[model samples]
Target: MSSPGPRRRGVSVPRPGRGWWVPAWAVLLAVVLLGPALAPGLVLSYDMVWVPDLTLRSDFLGLGSSLPRAVPSDAVVSVLDEVVAGWVLQKLVLLLPLVGGALGVVRPLRDLPLPARLVAVSLFVWNPFVAERLVMGHWPVLVGYGVLPWVLLLGRRWRVERRLPAALPVLVVAGSLSASAGVVTAVALVASVGLGSRTRAAVAVGLVAAANAPWVVSGLLHAAAGRSDPAGAAAFALSGEGSLPAPLAALSLGGIWNSEVVPHSRTGILAWVSLLVLLGLALAGGRRWWSRGRRDAATLAICWGVGLGLALLTWASPDAVAWVAAHVPGGGLLRDGSRQLALCVPLVASLAAVGTTRVLEWMEDAGAVMVAAALVVLPVLLLPDAALGVDGRLRAVDFPRDYADARAAIDEDAGPGDVLLLPLASYRQPAWNAGRKVLDPTGRYQSRDFVTSDALVVSGTVIAGEDPRVAEVARALDLPTPDERADALVRAGIGVVITDLEAPGEPPEVAGEPLLRGSRLEVSALDGARSPAPPTGWLWAMAAAWAAFVVPPVGVAAAAVVRRRRRRDTP
Candidate 1:
């Protein structure tokens, strides 16, 4: 419960008059790390897709025919995109973690010297975990990851005061941008605000649970909630790039499943050396950090242990993982195992700071202060490629002009019947995006009901898609004769078809003559469509679920009103 004060005399990284430099340094680091990601154009890497105009749709709320993997993040973006430009919103989403994380991570460690706080910021923001997640375009996860340390800071205060932080709901909601983000945030909230007092814990848990309602209610109401593809468990399991052991790789915060996202230096000897140094530093700090009666330390330690343990479960026991994924509703969310590793970040950063402090104190030489100052940017030195938008892997690119033209052409003739994206793929490796894999943006760009594939092909293995309509559409399109295919598609509600030339695969033989053709896109209108009406059964449920997010604020407002009345009455 007591702060470990400074280990010895303070060493100024800049000139430690005040701690103003902490946040300023964080902003600078964010600018450097997110160089191209903040450029004029949108960042459309892998899962991070931002369209010119994102409209509110059934899909955004998880009521679409396809899987709701994007869920509330898509919904949130659509809401924000109404006022803010898509490109700017994308930058904020990208910058939230890198900048907010540095600010959050240093809050608890302010008791330490300025140098130690700088070390925490650098380690927390510039590490492999943050880099890999950024490159892979999991911005929502990064948002939650950035919020973890702040949760810790507030949790410590909550425990001491026996009253919840007023900002807890806001923080939890911010963290719950996506289902994965929601899951992690809820776990963290529970861990940080433990059941020391039943009433306080209940209040905290209820608010946090309400924050997660968007995904929780949607996932449970989903038809496939009880069943998920188990094969993905093996496909997305965490590994050490086949160079280091899984545990050490995870401990070092480097083992992401997507080998392409892992920094080039991660496989080299320097990486191993860095990992050993990090472990040594953590051990050095843990002696002082993980002592008796400190609830903050316990919360972080529990998180690290549980996070690493679950991250390893998929690797250590594949069969068990497969069973769980198959049997549990929304268990497939955990298929990408490294997501759990996010919980390890707050603890590790703190340890690194305390460890740096102890190290500086131990080294009695005058130059030791100078040496400790260098530790602030050690994360950057160790993982140099993480800067400058992951070595230009995440450069912002404008959508080709054809996309806008196609959307307009399709919109004019688009009736009740659904539009189908041709070449029938979930991802597009567009040339404009430098051949980077991005989720097809056509659906969001045009405010229409566009049906596309959700199936993912990892390596050579094809994981089955969640949308049952995709297979039916594919079957209808694959009929023996062009006439038969066209007739079949028309009767089943294929209104307009848009084909992307940049994406691999030819347009359907049944696509007939193009209504509007561009260099990269071709739109064809189909007639005599009879599309089935979208299910409206879950609308009330979803509305109620969304309403839960509002309840906490209402409660807070009511509580404040009551306190005012009590003061007035006493006087």
Candidate 2:
């Protein structure tokens, strides 16, 4: 493999010098594209579930676990709600990753001219995959997607220089915030080490494992509890409609199962265009790697190869995907293999940046700018409707006043036992949400701790977890006799039964007086069994694991800052 020589009108052209302006321009472009998300009101959608009433939990530190994914975004949302009354914080939390991802894509192109760098950033951020994920409400994975390139960059520096970067811990924490992203980051780190120093890789791995101990411990506890669900694993296996081939989806980066999120007419066009651009750039990058054998390029090639290979396997082979999901710990976390294709985004973006620079060198400055501008704007023009709100499909809307009132009422009346939310469904079509797809918002609105029977829905099937309480609750609701139902509720340690009045059914006649009756909700107190608390040892163990994950990263980051300051003062 060799770098293609730049030629223009039969004359050779020289490469441009590195400059800081390209990154600054890339940041500006990202902010402009993602600016709408920063609007004043909540942008509600399927998985982008943010409510002002949601509170932080200590279990958020548990790595390789579900709760950990919401921790980062929840922190931001909570803080914003306390300081401000609008959706500005939620929007910023969502858009921050896009900005980081844009900068990550452009940063490696420091050697390239401004036009080419901008084109690469635009293509990376504005692609169909990003748009689809945004619509699907997987912003945490997107955050991981944004931080990945920087993680690789920092990991490479550590491997080569034998000194960890100050930002390495932060990047690791960001990347590991989501389970899918954590798996990708762990794999990338090991791969980066294989390409460089084994000793440095071991040290880096140790620190990462320490930082992720909370989730790892939680995962271990989950495994010990025999809570694994094979049906859930199989349901999450990668497969696509016959219309879109798995390989093409991997290349084009658009295998979203939800048809509503994808633009029907322009999907094929965007897919093919992205496929061709990425393949061409990857070929060029591969050639450069073969010739020079640079560690960075090799690491990127490995990432692209792994991401593409896994995506293809998951998408093309159902049995293989199911097998992996069942056998591989935490594999079930990635219900959509298309999300893994995000790893390829940065690699492709980097190659595209190089390709853009190469193509520009063959033309005059003005011609290069024109070509770059067209390339940068092409994806956006093709998928014009795939912005933050999916072109108005996901507009911001306020929750009804009744929701707040119900939450307040629950806080005042509910006992230590959990509130049982009715309808026992994983999803809801709330009247207030404008018919948009959303997770059950009862979890978000209730002030008292609550439980819902909404098992994780996959492939239109409700895959039940180890908890039999949801099933028990469903049975209790069907007992026919009010006394039996009341006894069942008591046995379940349910202090209050909150029924969604908007949930398309008449309220069940229970034995107790209605505590709070509103247009949207009805709450009734249940007297029977008390919910048992976990053993004291379990709580302490979780706390210890959380401390392990948090303390070292803070210390390392502080030490790095102090060392830098002391060196500066030495002058």
Candidate 3:
């Protein structure tokens, strides 16, 4: 094996302070990519709903009647939005990952030259995987993907130095924002930080479990609430984008099931070019990476192989995966196989960086620099549509004035029942949002328990949701006459009904004068209902789990502070 050195022949590692260019370039690329999407209003897209304020409730903590897909993510936002505007927080959530991901990908290849670092950052921050997930509005998933490199570094630090990373627990918590995020994070953590030392392995296990506790506890708490339809496993399975085949698509990191979110560029020649570049780089740098990062290479193999296998299984053998999702508790998370593909990123970014360095080594100074610069720009040319708000699918828009009016009217009464939305649909293609499809934002917009349809309809296929209360509420809406309907809704625990003016549905009438009426919404109160339920004992358990997940990282960070102080004082 080659000896470790700061300056290797033909490779040009960065001098200290000069490395600022890496993250600055990453931030610049992110700005170019996000473009208009970073404007003042909320950037609402598929599953990416942010409101002015989110009411903290048991439902937000996964004590809801349905699944905990948004669990700690919603809860986290609730806390953050208080300190920051939701619009600004949304932008930060979208921005931090791209910049952070670039830095993380560059960390492992610190010994490599500028060409290598630039290429890794470009590919990591601006690729089909990042593009598709961003357009799909899976912010937490991107957050998880961003943290994988740090997880790898932690494993290496422990393997070589036998020292636990102070930020180890923090990284896991960042990655474990959602159940799917937690699952992929766990895979990366285990693959990179295998059970070599008994003590480290034990700590790793505890960290993994603690990080995953929010979603796991939420899922278990609501386990008796319902089960997802087995059919979802097939519906959400990874598939080829446009004309590309599934396997090639997977290898190229371009297979996301929802074609709507895919950039138009992926449907054509850029796809093949990306595939070629990925394979060429891997082959070119494979040897160097193998020599330097043997353990990392093994971890990469496990992660990529397992990720690809699971991604394909969801497409080819949905029946088997569907069985697991049906029979296993908290297994529905595996239904979206495309998420696991995040596992393939660490090695790709690392190898691509070193590959550029190796390729540059063959040419003289001027030629090599130009080639490296061209490679840095090539990722942009290949996926040009990823920039400017993902081909303009992502743009900021303010909520209708009626939303605030309705909330204010409802806020005054301090009524009993949970808020109920009209139209009874799970997803909304709101006119206010330029007809972009989003999970209804009303639930998060108001300071009340807003019950919405749990079922999701994708590509004309309806995947039943877990909440049985959705059915009872739907039945209440079907009752004859305004009085009977109002009575049924109140008895069924609907405190108020807020109907969207733009949505296509006949909102049931209430006998009394409406509380608030506007161009966009009609708010009516049901007089007989009781106020929202108080916090159950389960909420304390949920809080404790979140505290457990967070406290270790706090302790570690505090200890680091103390040690630094002691060293300074002695000197």
Ranking by lDDT: 3, 1, 2
| lDDT tens digits, residue span 97-183, model 1 | 778877887777766777778888888888888889888889999999988777777777887888767767777888888877777
In order, the Cα lDDT scores of the candidates are: 0.79, 0.65, 0.82
Model 3 residue pairs with clashes = 416-530, 416-531
Q: TM-score for each prediction?
A: 0.94, 0.88, 0.94
Better of 2 and 3 by lDDT: 3
Query: Which regions of candidate 2 deviate over 4 angstroms?
Result: 1-36, 58-86, 193-196, 224-235, 239-242, 283-286, 289-293, 324-329, 364-366, 456-459, 504-509, 568-571
Kindly report which residue pairs in candidate 1 clash with one another: none
lDDT of 2 by residue, 253-308 (tens): 67665666775533565556656776765665445434433666777778878787
Q: What is the TM-score (0 to 1) of candidate 2? A: 0.88
Instruction: Give the candidate number with the greatest TM-score.
Output: 3
Q: Could you give candidate 3's per-residue lDDT for residues 1-571 as a string of tens digits?
A: 1314233456443332445779888999999999888999998888998898877887887766667889789898999889998889989989888888789878877777776788988988888888899888899999999888788778667766888778877888889999888878888888777878888788888888998888788778777664568989888888898788878888888788888888999999889898899889888877878888577789888888888888888888888888988877777777888888888887788888778867877666677778888888888989999998888888999998888888899899636778888888878889989999998888788888778888888889998887877888888777887888878778777888888778876666655448887988878888887644535777787887888777888888899889889999995
Any runs in candidate 1 off by more than 4 Å, and if so which? 9-17, 511-513, 553-571
Count backbone overlaps in model 1.
0
Candidates in descending TM-score order: 3, 1, 2
> Residue 64's C-alpha lDDT in candidate 1?
63
Top-lDDT structure, candidate number: 3
lDDT comparing candidate 1 with the true structure: 0.79
